[model samples]
Target: MFLDNLSAFLTHPVTGTVLLMVGIIGIALELLFFSSGLLALAGVAGFGLYFLGFYLAGFASFGDLAVLGLGLVLLILELVVPSFGILSVLGAICLFGGVLMASSDPKEAAFMLVIALLVAIVVVIAAIRTFKHRGIWNRFILKEQLTMSKGFTSSPDRSNLVGLTGEAITPLRPAGTALIQGERVDVVTHGSFISVNKAIIVVEVEGVRVVVKAADDQPNH
Candidate 1:
């Protein structure tokens, strides 16, 4: 009787939805926190169980499983290589299509899938915002790259100091710091040595490399 009850639950609509939600949350957690940790395994297992339940209930076909496998591959590729979210989107579509194929009732499957996704999104948001400060988050997620991935960035545009003039803060033996516009900036000379506190002028600017030369009273060549 216990075995029968377990089987019934496994085949239940709610169980399938819960499994899908777990799959989504697990994978998301793995990516956000684990990097290459056990959360990813949990996600894979969740998806596996979800499909397995449908198969045991005689609802999922081999073709459906194949599609799900393709989706998984796409998602993995999305992580390993940056495709600007294109691979991720395609993977999601494939997974959804697989779910539809595996369901005996397409409309009911879609409804459950939609509900699971909405709840997963809410759960993920809460985890990221409300519980982000909790110790558990830092333990799971790689915080080292968090700042660089989505935070304040250093300005790389040094084109403003192109025409500005300044003094050499350090001896520019082809590469040194100079005081440009009264501000000490890192500058480089074109194969010419610049002395300290020398009257230098900006000759050219190539991106962040501030090219400079001694301000000699001669033809402005």
Candidate 2:
């Protein structure tokens, strides 16, 4: 008699629909928004109530509850740990299986599963777009912008070194170190190899690049 009453209450059309909606919405919200676990708790509670109702109605069994619990645990772990999407896939599969098993009618179960999946996808896409530009999302997504306004300079200005004379300290197969005014400076030769200890003159300085040529070589115009 007790079981019959419980089944009657749970199988009520309005109550069953409401419970399912609450569970779906709660889980979606929890996944999309970064709350202090309040949304997660609500989601868990909603799912718990949903399963309890189904069990009371004889539409679900203890095995169904176990499967659902496993799915929930896997999903939670996917969020907390980085499994490269492995956990997520497994969790989704478990959830689908559990939900299917919990429904007495195959058609109803299939319909509900489709609706739930579509809703989850839409919510996830929307959330990603909305939060993609935020700073908090940067930690998970790699984004970098280098601008002069941000004080990011790719190369230093070496124009001052122009016209300075230096002696090649190392062979410049177009690039090597030189001694300019007793200070070691990095420099590049002008299309020709310069031997060590040879006198060279800086003919051009572009950004951080110091271009030099043999002192006796005719300078290019």
Candidate 3:
């Protein structure tokens, strides 16, 4: 009888609704507060478990497959193309659809949604515990790991601004604009805001950004 109750509890409408709420909240927090540490990983894991539970409950359907496909595509797009919100929007839609499809009934779907949401909360909490002081994750799911996998790739140098002298087109209050070699470029000052049109000398060159200081302050140009 306990097994029966347990099964019933798993399918309970209130339980599912709670899960869905927690999942959505987790996803929202993860996406919005990206710097919130391990929240993002927790969100992903929560979404996975939510659907996995629904599928195991024999509530899956054709719609769930479509949702899974769309989710995967959207997820891939996120990694390929960096954007502010496209990935998040598509991800949410796909996740919602997946939950909806997996449930045998609307009631079950609702229940699963709640459960999934709760799972997201738990994952987030756990992630916070594990990754609190660590650096970025940069994994496939997190994308932090992927960046680390690629290592530090230097940017291309298109501008031959090295060893060139120019004037400040705009005051760089630490980061400002300076004209070098007839081409206007952004530059960093040595904690001094060079006045506009101030004669500046390039001290070092790295990638596109040039470091500059007042021409008079330079010991060697």
Candidate 4:
């Protein structure tokens, strides 16, 4: 007797459609080729389709509401709480139970499940395409910027400064070159300008030049 009733319910068109949609959705989610939004959409549509089919088949409205509420709660929990393994399992249970509760016949519920899977699958594919096209899903997501910010520094070449400090390189007519460590570098005189080769200290280093000042006063010649 139960088998005959189940067979008759499965023959319903609405039941079959929901079942197909559910299968598709399940496959799409597993493959990761769809977006979350698409999944949500499929869930909503699948729920509605199953509910309508059962209502048309003469199920009591009150029981249907209770079942629908449970399904909705499950979905809400999925979004509100961290998965924790419990939310997903509970949500699936609630959803399946809700469909069975809402349906006038068990076979109709099965049919709707299949349709729901199919819908889920299609939506999942669309979701994947949507994400890929947005450029967010690409391997190299960031394009290097041409303009660099301040504070960026590169390593200096130590050999470039090999002999460029402490020599009487600058004449100090306020400006001239100094030979320090065997290299010529521009330097400046501090306080009063002095002639070249009167003993100097490296006052500062700016780029290729080591600025200097006379240690003591000396003859202009």
Candidate 5:
């Protein structure tokens, strides 16, 4: 009797609509805000209640429930494991299929799915603009800028070596090491291979890259 009464209430259009909205909103907020799983739990609960109500009302078959459960698992996996949106796409298809199968009215299910998608998109965009720098995204993204002021350099500056002459320590197939000012420095030639022990001049220095040419070769400048 209690189950029947609960089903009678849940099967009402208003109750189903409310439950569906709550589930979708909760899940979206969980993904966007990373609310320490509170919103996710609430969303799970909402979905659980919805499925139970529908099952009791004879609106959902075992297969429908299984499909919905699989979809929910895939969606959760998408959050835990990044598959570059593959899991999300599959989960969406399964979720929609399950909803359609469970609903007596396909039109109503489709309408609700559309609303859910719109809400999710809006929430994701807003969250990205507001909280992107702080939350889960930060874990997988590089947010630091490497500038001279920050003492971050990709390589040591070789500008001081310009106009200096050095002997090639290794054959330069356009790239080799040279002893300049008694310090071994890496250098590249202008599309020409230089033999080992060959005398070379530092023709240019761009950041960490030292450009060299044969000592007998005239400097471009």
Candidate 6:
């Protein structure tokens, strides 16, 4: 009984399109933000519901599911291991292909997929510009502005601070301010928390990122 209703609803163009949009957005959120698992779950549920309905209605074949699964696996692998966008592109193709195969009408499904993809892109852009959520984009997007083409020789010289010891003026719960070389500079520890007033030393400086380590943690020169 419930399956019948679900099948009917999912088969409709409008409802199905909405579901697809929601599913894509959810998946984008899962990939973009590194936070609570709720968004990821919601995205998974959207895909699950969409496919389940199609399966119950006999519109989705094992081949379609296999394609979608393969696509998703590639996308996840892209995140876990860097493939320089190769995996991402391939994954998106398979994902859309699978969804289109199970769709009642290929035309409507393609149109709807484009819309959802656009919306998801907008969401990602907004998230990148507005919030500092520190998600997958940090890895994917290049943030350095000081390049030779831009009239700057290097990424804002902070290399002089290397080997210099400093004091954490603020709590470095991995990221905070530290007094280094007589300047209050923004800094980050090596994935460890250093309490206020703890001794620290400059370790690595890449581009604008300043990495510090606990003074005691550093080996003797």
Q: Tell how far residue 64 is off in model 2, in angstroms.
A: 1.2
Q: Which tens-of-lDDT digit does each residue in 27-99 have in candidate 4?
A: 2353243344475566566556556545554663767657665655665565556465476566666666766
Q: lDDT per model, in order? A: 0.78, 0.74, 0.65, 0.56, 0.79, 0.79
lDDT of 2 by residue, 1-221 (tens): 88777667665545555555555555555554545567667767756766776788778999998898887788678668848768867876776687678877757766765665566567567766876564235557648788878887888767888998989999999999999989898999767999999999999988888999998897469
Specify the poorest-scoring 10-residue window by lDDT in model 3.
Answer: 134-143
Candidate 1 regions with alpha-carbon error over 4 angstroms: 1-7, 130-221
Worst 10 residues of 2 by lDDT: 11-20
Q: What TM-score goes with each of the models?
A: 0.59, 0.70, 0.41, 0.41, 0.71, 0.58
Q: Residue 106's C-alpha lDDT in candidate 3?
A: 62
Q: Candidate 4 — which residues are off by over 4 angstroms?
A: 1-12, 15-46, 132-221
List model 1 lDDT by residue over 1-221, tens digit each: 66456546765789988988887887776555545747667767878887777787778889999998888788777667757678878988888898888888889889888998999899888877865665334755777654436764455667777767788888989899987766778888889898898888888877678898888736657
Better of 1 and 5 by lDDT: 5
lDDT by residue for model 6 over 101-194, one digit each (tens)? 8776778778878887787788767877777547766766677776777777745688888989999999998999999878999999879999
Kindly report which residue pairs in candidate 5 clash with one another. none
lDDT for each residue of candidate 3 in 127-182, tens digit (9 for 90 to 100): 76776544224432453444434764456563466567789988778888887778
RMSD to true structure for each model, in Å: 9.0, 4.0, 13.3, 12.1, 4.3, 15.4
Error of 1 at 71 (Å): 0.8
Tell me the TM-score of model 4: 0.41
Could you tell me which 10 consecutive residues in candidate 1 have the lowest summed lDDT?
131-140
Clashes of 2: 0
lDDT of 1: 0.78
